[model samples]
Structures are given as C-alpha cells and as structure tokens.
Target: MTAHGLVIGKFYPLHAGHLGLVRFAASESAALTVIVLGTVFESGSHERRADWLRAELAAAGAELGHVEVLAVRCDAPEEYGTEIAWVANVAIMRAALAAAGRPAPTAVFSSEPYGVELAARFGAEHRAYDVAREGHPISGTAIRADLAGRWSEVAPAARLDLATRVIVTGAESTGTTTLTTALVDHYRANGFAAMPVVPEYGRDFTYELHAETEERLGREVAMDDLVWLPEHFARIAERQNELEDAAAMACPLVIADTDAFATELWERRYLGATSDETHRFGTDRLPPRDVYLVTDHVGVPFFQDGWRDGEHIRADMNGWFVDELTRRDASWVLLRGAPEERLRYAVRLIDALWARNATFASPPWRSSPPSVE
Candidate 1:
C-alpha cells in the first residue's frame, strides 16, 4: 500500500527549515500533501503563502515526486493546549482530501512534536522529520525579526518584505536613474534575479508637468508654482511607494532610482510645504529603506531638455540633499565623479554590505562586476 503523507505549517515566511520537512516527507512517501494553514491574523496573507507554497512545490521537481500544496484560511480557536485547534485542523484536512477524491492520510509527517498527536486522531502512523533542526537550522521568527541580516532564510516571494532596498537619489542630471538601471542590469547579469529597478516616479511625473506648462502655456514652471501648487507631489509619492514595494518581491536587492523620500525633499524645495496627505503617506506607509546613495551634481553636465530644470536648480537641490542627510544622520553615501567612477564606487559599497550579511545560501554576486572605466 502506498503511503499518503501530510505536513502542516503556517509558513509565515516559508524558510528553508520548512522546506526540509516537506522534502523529507516527499522522499519517504508515495504521495505527499503539504498544508499551509493560515489564519485571519497571520503576518502574511493566505493568498501570498498559497502562491509561495505552490511555487516551491513545483520547483521541488522529482525530488518531491507526487505532491500537492494546499492553503487554508481556517482559524483554529485560541485555547491553550486544547484539542479544539487540532480538531479543527483535522476536519479541514479530511474534508480537503475527500473533496479531491483522495483518501485520509495514512501517515502524518512533521518537524514539530504535534505530528504524533495529529496522526493518532486519524489512526495513522507518525513519522518525525528533522525535529532537531539538523539540516536547515533557521526559523520564520528569526527571519522576520532581522530580515536584512538573515536574507537567505526567506523564499523569493517573501523577499519583498525582507530584501534590502537601496535608494539612488539626487537632483535631476545627477545620473541617479543611470546608476539605478545599470546596477539592476549588473546584478541580473551577475546572477541575482531579484534586483528589479523602481524607476523614478517623480521624474516621470515632473516631465508631465513640464510638458503641460511649457508646451500648452508656453512658459516654464516657476519655483513659486511648484511650492504653492501641492497636489501632484502627493500622487507621485503614493505611486512611487507602490512601484518600489512591487519590485521588491522578486529580488534580494531593490535598486530604486529614487524613493518617495527624495520626492518629498524636492517638494519641500519647490513647494514651500508638501501636501499633508503625501507627507503622511510616505512617513507611515513606506517601509524603512536599507540605504541611500545620493549622486553629487558638481561638474556633471546639466542638460536642459525641454522638460528638465536648469543646472542652477539641480545644483541647489543637490546641496539641500547633502544638508538634509547631515541633519538626519541617515544611512547614506555620496556618488561623485565620472559615470564609470560613480557606478564602481556605489557597487563597492553595496558589495560590502552584501558580504557582511550574506549566509552563503542566498545567490552570490561577489565577483567583480564589469566596470565601465
């Protein structure tokens, strides 16, 4: 008789430790069913965990031969040491199997102690997996608490929440977008898939303003107009935050051209006061970024395309950024000199950060990336 096995977990972030138990059961059983039990009050959404679990199972390939992954939104009642939770969980399992025309599990497998008790209720055998945490010694809790320091423990789907976001920002014509786009390409070519680029939302939004004002009105937008007219910045901030967060899920490092904070700075400079809605949105909604690279405007060629501001505004805003960073004592570094020089210098800083926190399980990018100089 072929053994049908079951494994259950919250998979809060679905680290390697959970994968080990799933893989172990796969090797031991003829067919395995993995249950990702989620509640209304879990850290990650049920839909997200379901998607991540499905991806991992498919990626498991022949190593986990016949397998299925299931996600349930069943909320086990909160009662310490009560069978209410266990009973509820078992009911879901039985109902799920029956609904699929499969039999009740012949064996229950798990890395935790509950497997024995769970299996007993179904009159099935219990097989304890790596209860000692021998193979992959990591936990979702540990991953959640210190995500930057524990990047390798998380699945790709969970990375958006845990990955380090490096914001490249400065005044127009400072090569901010150039560096951001280049870094993403460099990482992908060098074997880091999650290095998605969050293109400059503010820059794109500003271009629209310039087009409308300069072409239609046939006049350049004055500083007073930007400062006093407050609505557009708010929309840009919300959009920028969305774009950055969306890009974070696929890669370990998010290389943003500029984040909302940079947008806020420009709003402060051009508009005396930013819209309250946009300011609060950036402050409360956006996650804390890992670092900032502000490109220096000194000696850089300032091109005045029909849409761009003059070199004077670019230079003045760059000084304001430097001053603000000094006041806040934030995590930041200056990218100065030629294009090639700036790229190389910024990569070196990021490379050091990657090395210090790397766990060797996450993909590596330590080799020298192609230099432009």
Candidate 2:
C-alpha cells in the first residue's frame, strides 16, 4: 500500500537540515505534504518558506514530482509538547489539509520528539530522523544567532532571498564589468565558491537586436541607426532583474555588472527621458540593493567599445547615477582613481555591506527574566 507522509515546521528560515528531513520523508512515502507553520512574530514569512521548498523540490530531481508544499499559520500561546498545544496544533494542521483538499497523512516525519504525538493525533505512524541533529548539526536558533557565519546552513533558495545584492553601475565603458568581476574574484578567492556575477543583460540584448536589424536590412548598421522604444527598454530592464534574481538565489553574495535599477538611467540617456512604463519595469521593481558601487568617469578614460555612444556622455551618465541614487536614498559609493584603488575601496564597501546584511532579525520570543528579589 502507498503511504502519504506529513512534515511540519516553522522553517522560519529554511535550512539544510529541514531539506534533509523532507527528503527522508519523501523517500519513505509515495507522496509528501510539507506544512510550513508560521506565526506573525516570526522574522521570515511563511509563504516565502513554501516557495523555497518548492524550488528545492524542483531542484531535487528524485523528489521533484512527489512533494507538495503548503503554508499554515498557528499562533497558539500554549508551549509546544504540552497537551493543550498538541490539541490546538493538530486542529490547525487538519484544517489546513482539509482546505487544501488533502487526506489525513499515513505517516509523519520530523526531526523533533513531538512527531510521535503529532502522528498519534492524526492516526499516523511516526518516523523520526536526526532527533539529535547529528547529521546536519544545525538549527534555526543557531542559524538565527549568526546567519552570516552559518550561511551554508541556509537552503539555496532562501539564501537568495537573504543575500546581499551589490550592483556595479555607471556610464558605458566606465569599468563596471571590471569591478564586478573583481568583487566576485575577491570573494571566491577567499573560499566562497558560490559567488555569482551577473553580467549586464542589456548590453547583450542591444547587440542581438542590432544584429537582427542589420540582417533584415542586408547591410551593416551603425549603433546610432538603431531605434529606441519604451518596450525595448522595458524588456531589457525586466531581463536584467531576472538575471540578478537568479544569481542572488544561487549564492550568498551577488555582484552584477548592471541591474534593472540602472536601466532606468540608460533609458533616459537614450530616449531623452524615461517613460513611466520603463520605470515600472525597471527601478520600480528592483529588489532591495545592499549597495551600488558607481564608477566615476572623472579620471577614468572611456573606451569606445563598438556599442558605446561616445566619451562625452560618460560624465553625464556618472552624474545621473549619483543624483538618482541620492533621490532614492539608496546606499552607494563612487569608485574613482586607478583600477586597483577602485577595487580596494569596492572591497571595503562590499565587506561592510556583507557585515550589515549578515545580521538577522531576532525571533519574537524572549527568555524569561530573572525573578526580582
């Protein structure tokens, strides 16, 4: 007979341990339902945890099609492992399963001792794994205490949501790519194997579009011959954001040559001014940037890459970046002087950004204070 398994947890910030347990459950049953229990006081949202599990399952080739992720909220004041908490928690879990049109689970999988009671309440068998956390040797509590230090414990998808996104943006030929690569190298050289650098998608898009247009006309076309449209920029901006987001999820730190937010300025530069639609597609949809490392054009010579407009516009674009980043109250640093000096300052800024973002929000519950005399 086939068995349906159930696993429940807050997964306040889903970690590798949770993934291992879920995988174990999937192995023991034909189908598995993982409930992400959440409370308002938790730092991370329940829905986001569900999304992470789904992404993880998709990536786990063996368990891809059999696992289901669901979200349920429980704010019962009763402490876990108590009779009252069991009764309350079980009821909520049942209601959630019913609302999702799922049947009572045949087996319950967990890393906690309460799995026995939880399974008993649902007339299911308890299959516990790693009650002592010997395998993963990690917990949400420990991870919360030092999220940055314990980053490897976080699930891949959750890492993206919590990672610091640093965008290197400035005018054309201002060494944005150079600085981005340097940052990635700095981190990877120090043992961060997962550091991903997202290249500027807009540049590729522009090149491809120009090539196609030239092909249709059966003639070589100058960059100036290309036409600009709001929709074109909108597509570029959306794709840029997509690239950055994918990189963020893959690693703890994302260094992008340019990003959707910077696309807005490019739109203005090419089209005289940004259209409302361009902003909506680009800057308006930006994920929270930890910081932007802007390359200054003051001392840097602009190289006329075939696609570049000209050297004259470099200073203008640099100024626009500063003004716009300031208007949005965004954290940014201007990188000037030699390439090595620029990289040193960029590293310092990124280290600071990592330190700041590494701090996690404390969970709501607090330990009891010493009794007063």
- The TM-score leader among the candidates is 2
Clashes of 1: 3
Candidate 2 lDDT by residue in tens digits, 109-144: 887766787789999998888877799888877777
lDDT of the candidates, in the order given = 0.71, 0.80
Best by lDDT: 2
Per-residue lDDT of candidate 1, residues 1-373 (tens digit): 3389887777767777777777778888888887776666545465677677677776767676588877666565533256775677678777877776667788888776566778898889988876677777777656655555466677755565546678898998888878888888887777575556688887687767766766766777653343326678888888998888777765667788887777778678776766787777667776557778999888788876655657778877888778876776678898889888888888888887655433322113212201000
Worst ten-residue run, lDDT, model 2? 364-373
Pairs clashing in candidate 1?
A: 194-250, 194-251, 227-271
What TM-score does candidate 1 reach? 0.57
**Candidate 1: C-alpha lDDT:** 0.71
Which regions of candidate 1 are displaced past 4 Å? 1-114, 117-157, 210-228, 360-373
